[model samples]
Target: MPYEVQGVVSRAKGEPVSLETVIVPDPGPGEAVVSVKACGVCHTDLHYREGGINDEFPFLLGHEAAGYVEQVGPGVTDLAPGDFVILNWRAVCGTCRACRRGRPWYCFNSHNANQSMTLADGTRLTPALGIGAFLEKTLVHAGQCTKVSPEAEPAVAGLLGCGVMAGLGAALNTGAVGRGDTVAVIGCGGVGDAAIAGSYLAGARTIIAVDTDDRKLEWAKGFGATHTINSRGLGQNDVVQAIRELTDSFGADVVIDAVGRPETWKQAFYARDLAGTLVLVGVPTPDMRLDDMPLIDFFARGGSLKSSWYGDCLPSRDFPMLIDLYLQGRLPLEKFVTERISVDGVERAFERMHKGEVLRSVVEFS
Candidate 1:
């Protein structure tokens, strides 16, 4: 039987989300039903609520989640009922060119639930990131579930489902930060701080964190930032100069632009040592452009300028490893959860997120 549950839904653009009845169908072929325990409030969910993603109205808005498998549909052998898992947006199809090339992280064709969840009136609801989970239960493609150690708390482990993963992956995977490297992360929010943590874990010799907000900079310190720069009143060159000064008159080996604006990206481009890498992990609006940048700069600066899609992560491989690290206390994953909230508090959580008051406000199911 289909399950009817109360889920947070964005009925229209820019309007506050509300608790609505969501109809989640039983797992069909290659799908699974998960009993969601906790889901994080991320900036991406706020973007969806504001119509930044699309015109897909009435979005079932939550994706950064961890849960137990309640049921599995036909042909799903890897997971079974009671398996603890983190939900991932990208479910790689092995036949895709990227997957065939052994780079499934870049899989062009990812999977979501084959069936749609709906509102009480039978209107189809678009699940946020194809895994609407800000509720008691969710439906997803079987491949979307990545099993991990059950010892980690739901609120902490669920973060690997999105933002935290993006940050860690940006530094470790995309940037290829290594031991004794100098790294700088721009925009010290949850993602930027995660980058700092990743850099620390990778044995980066110096980690510089840049942000306009002092509070976030302090938060960065806890994540292992070796230096902090308040760039609020500084020009782009000034910010770049501060980073260079901190890195022994040379720029960092890797500079990550977690802000995603053209100005921040430019700073990151100039603040890297010659032939150093620049990783862009932040999400930008569609209308944002970089037409003014001189083409010669790209040629003059000889290094990789890469955009990290979900930190270029392979869920099946990364999620379990990260969970184990968290369990062993090697990774401070629990620090990311600023507060635990009831599902109804999500709208308020969005307000606090905009104000930069919390790293994450997770909705915990009773």
Candidate 2:
């Protein structure tokens, strides 16, 4: 039977999201119904509200989430009711070409609930990132649910579903920031700050954080940034030179563009040392272009330039281990939850996110 639940929904482009009666269907084959406990308000949710992602209106707008499985459809052998899990978008399809090559993290064909959740009028809803959890109950693919330590707070654990995971993966997996590697992360928002934290955890010697916001830069320091650069009112050369100056005049070994603008990406291109890796984890809009004559620079740079999709992370592996680390007091997962609000507060939370008032505004169901 389909269940009608109150959920945050963006009904049209540039329209405010409202709590609507969302029709969540019973789990079909390979699907599960999650009793969502908590979900984080991420920038992507804002993107959906603003029509920045796509024309997929009436989007069920929350993804970074954690909850417990309430029911599992037939053929779902691994997960059962009462299992605690973090919802992830990248539910790897084992048969994808990338998965066949043994790199499931790069699975081209990801999984979502086969059946559609709908509105009261039966208009199908596009669940954000395929694991919409702003609702009290959400339907998702069984593979999209990664079980983790139930002891972990749902608010903290949920962030691993998206932004935090993306940032951490940018450093640890894509950038490969190893011991003693000098790292510079542009934009000290939640994502960039996570890169800073990841770099610090990976033993980065000189961690430099660049952002226009001093408050965010201060937040970066808490995440173990050894140096902070206020990039506002400064030219690209100035920011690049500043980072170079901080890292023995050569430049950082890894430069991460967490801002995702063309200018920010170009700064990452020039702010790294010879043979240094550059990781672009920020989500750019469709219209943002990288034009100009930089053919010689791409060759002269002599390093890998990578785009980090969902931090190039494998949820099955990362979520559990990260939960353990968080429980062990090794990872500061709690720091990500800047504020906790109820589902009704998500629209205001989006405003807060736009103004950079919080790292993560989580919706707690309780």
The top-ranked prediction according to lDDT is 1
lDDT of each: 0.95, 0.94
Per residue, candidate 1 scores C-alpha lDDT tens digits across 23-118 of 999999999999999999999999999999999898999999999999999999999999999999999999999999999999999999999999
Clash number for every model?
A: 0, 0
In angstroms, give how far residue 223 of model 2 lies from its true place: 0.7
CA deviation > 4 Å runs, candidate 2: none
RMSD of 1: 0.7
Against the correct fold, how does model 2 do in TM-score?
0.98
Off by over 4 Å in 1: none
How well does each candidate superpose onto the true structure, as a TM-score?
0.99, 0.98
- Clash list (residue pairs), candidate 1: none
164-236: candidate 2 lDDT, tens digit per residue: 9999999999999999999999999999999999999999999999999999999999999999999999998
